[model samples]
Target: MKCLLVSDSHGSETELSEVIERHRGEVDAVFHCGDSELSNDSSILEGVHTVQGNVDKPGEFPEDTAETVKGVRVYVTHGHLYNIKMTHIPLSYRAEETQARMACFGHSHHPTAFEDQGILFVNPGSVMQPRTRPEQTYAIASFDESGGAEIRFYERESAEEVTDLYASFPAGTQ
Candidate 1:
């Protein structure tokens, strides 16, 4: 299945709607890593799974979530819960505890995609912050039952990419 990962869109429904409408048939699911500042209304999210971010007010999510997607054990979180900016050591430890194949998070407002410990770690960056790079970005990860993972980084609003980096892992590693 193909999933779109976005974050730190503090109420850009235009981009949200455009992305959903544009990727209508391309991806199976859209995951928003919060800081959305939007309510739980279906219209804004239309076809996405969203979690709360630091600025996302109250009652969005407790902390983290673990789920199985396309036969891959996936974990999603905002990363602020564990003070991740200073280091990934703690984050890696938490991921190990979850037994997840891929972990997704946002908070650094920087796009990253890589494999570590046989798992994929992705950060979709901030859709509204002053990023270190020129393009405000988001991520898309496609995975099959065979555990092959493909990652694409897209520039916000442009619908294109600043880079195209891909990687995959063997199945049953997590």
Candidate 2:
């Protein structure tokens, strides 16, 4: 399965639509990492999975979300409750409890993806308000019930993949 990962759009209807159109048939899922602040649009509800960010005025976004997509246990959160800007301790704890192979979160507006402690942590950066000496960025992930997962990060406008990573949990662990 392929998934488009986004975060911190802040409220860009056009960019959101661009994401949808860019990955239309390319991926099976589209995940908004956080900070969309689109409580009114709800178009996200159509073909995306999302979590509430610190700025989100919520209607139905869960603090933490878990979903099984194409046989992978995925975790979603805004990372504020996890104190992501400080560290991933809180998010790590939840991943252990959930046995989630992949955990996605956003708050720092930096695009990153990595593997540690048998879990994959991803932050798709601020697609709108990017920080930390980089252009606005987002990410995507592809998975199979095989050895590992492949993740890629891209500049929003050029769609240039600037970073890539591969993750594989130890044997007999998910």
Candidate 3:
């Protein structure tokens, strides 16, 4: 299965719509890690799995969520409550408790993807306000039956793959 991971749009309807349109049929699922600053009923979020960010209004979106895709458990959050800017330890602990094979989050607006103790952690950066990187970014992750996964980061507007940001993990590692 293929999943599109994005976050921190901070209210760019055009960009979010463009991304959904671009990957609509190509991916099995779409995850919005939060800070969208859009309403829960926004058309742009029609089929997206989303969480709430610090800036988002409470009671509309969940603080965190989990989904099972192609037999892999994926945890999604906004990172504020977990204090992700200082460390991923808290989030990692949550992932472990949930038995999630991967965790996706945003808040630092830094595009990053890495594995620790078999679980993959990804931050797709801010699609509307990127930081710590020149280009705004998001990630596409593909998982196979054997449990192997590959993540490829891409420049948001251009939809260009950042080859150097690519990562691959063996089966069952996460």
CA lDDT of 96 in candidate 2?
77
Per-residue alpha-carbon lDDT of candidate 3 for residues 11-35, written as tens digits (9 for 90 to 100) = 9999988988899899989999999
Candidate 3 lDDT (Cα, 0 to 1): 0.92
TM-scores vs. true structure, each candidate: 0.87, 0.89, 0.97
Give candidate 2's root-mean-square deviation (CA, Å).
Answer: 2.4
lDDT per residue for candidate 2 within 1-174, as digits (tens), equals 678888889888788768667876888788887788887457654668888888888655767778877877889888988889998888999987898888999889977777778788998888889888467888788876673687787888887777543333443453
On TM-score, who's better, 1 or 3? 3
Model 3 stretches with alpha carbons more than 4 Å out: 172-174
Backbone collisions counted per model: 0, 0, 0
lDDT of 2 at 149: 80
State the lDDT of candidate 1 residue by residue for 60-107, as single tens digits: 654677767667677778888767677666777777799987788888
Q: Select the stronger candidate by lDDT from 1 and 3.
A: 3
RMSD of each: 2.2, 2.4, 1.0
Relative to the unseen true structure, what is the C-alpha lDDT of residue 139 in candidate 2, on a scale of 0 to 100?
Answer: 79
